[model samples]
Target: MFLEREEYAILRSHVHADSVDLVDALAATGLRWSEMAALPPRDLTLHGSRPMLRVQRAWKRIDGGKALGAPKTKRSRRTLVLSPYLVQPFKRNCAGKQPNDFVFTAPEGGAWDSGGFYHAWTRAVSTMRVGRPRSPPRPVTASPNDRVSTTSVTRPQSHDLSHTHASWLIAKKVPLPGIQARLGHESITTTVDRYGHPLAMLDDEIIEAIEWSMNPMAA
Candidate 1:
């Protein structure tokens, strides 16, 4: 499930202010929540000509709880260039922290736990689509003639941002191999299987590009 740019903007608004950066970063970088949650100040290079985020570690499930460990796959350990728009947010998260300090934290402090974030995400999406939560279904006890109206909306998992990221890249015509590498897919086939088709909305853009390529007037 991919969200258009403006739709993403609305979803971002529904998340907590402290989590806004994390949400934006996820949409921007395609980092898995575990990789993102485990990011440290040292992992980000927010200055210089090429600002980037280094994904080396992730929070992995352990017997009792979880621990910082290698990512699920070696390919998942990769570097992602940051768009200029994310520079300030990344830098802001990096400031006043030691190299090992967590970059994205909960409002009360400490690294974010996945389970804890679910409630916030649920609430945000519940109201995000209709600008309010859906109405409950009518109880069986209600009269047969009673009206039962409810709003139906998609509650996309936060991980959907990863797919959304790939779609955005596809829209921009970023090469499949490049996107595969950026997304750290273990195999190019995974990337192809997931996002091979260009979005229908891009047909016009594709035509325009083809025309420009055939003409010397393209600048």
Candidate 2:
């Protein structure tokens, strides 16, 4: 599931200072976690009229360690445009790094493993109370009724941010093809199948047009 704007803000506020840029980059670009982890400074195009992130390789976990390899699919190796707001975070991340150096590295200057990234994300989200606690039917207990509490906390995987980004684009009415290209989906059908629900936002407008067509006098 995708994060709402306020929840996203809360999550961002709680990210560790060292990982702020990494989290920001994920939210901004919607790159897969592996892609983000393997991004190099050279992949960033911050100077040109169209700033973008060049997706090349991803960090893949092997038997004993990790390796940088081509993206999951050829389409996944496409370039994505960056919003102006995202440029500074990328710039901050690129500073003092060589072109070949990874843009977002671990504290020890290695590719960030999935485990470490998950830990950092958990630490950031643990601070906030996400949703209301549900009161389950009082457990049948021998003693006085103890409340069975269940809170709906939003524990989004790092990849969910990519979903969030696509949701935002869909909410803003970006075209399916554009979204497909930005997400590097090999087929427009993939993008549509994944996010077509958001297009329901047009339901009311469609209904209005149909009504107008049925009764010209109403117009």
- Give per-residue CA lDDT, model 2, range 46-78, as digits (tens): 987899889999977789888989998988989
Per-prediction TM-score, please?
0.81, 0.83
Query: Model 2, stretches more than 4 Å misplaced?
Result: 131-154, 208-219
How displaced is residue 173 in candidate 2, in Å? 0.2
After TM-score superposition, the amount by which residue 4's alpha carbon in candidate 2 deviates from its true location, in angstroms, is 1.3
The weakest ten consecutive residues by lDDT in model 1 span 126-135
The pairs that clash in candidate 1 are none
Candidate 1 per-residue lDDT, tens place, 1-219, comes to 777788898888888777788889999999999999999999889889999889999999999889999988989999999999999998898889999989988878898989877777787887677233356777979998988777654467889899989999988878878999899999999997887564565678879999999999887
lDDT at 131 for candidate 2? 41
TM-score of candidate 2 versus the correct structure, residues matched by position: 0.83
Model 1 bad stretches (over 4 Å): 130-151, 197-219
State the C-alpha lDDT per candidate.
0.86, 0.83
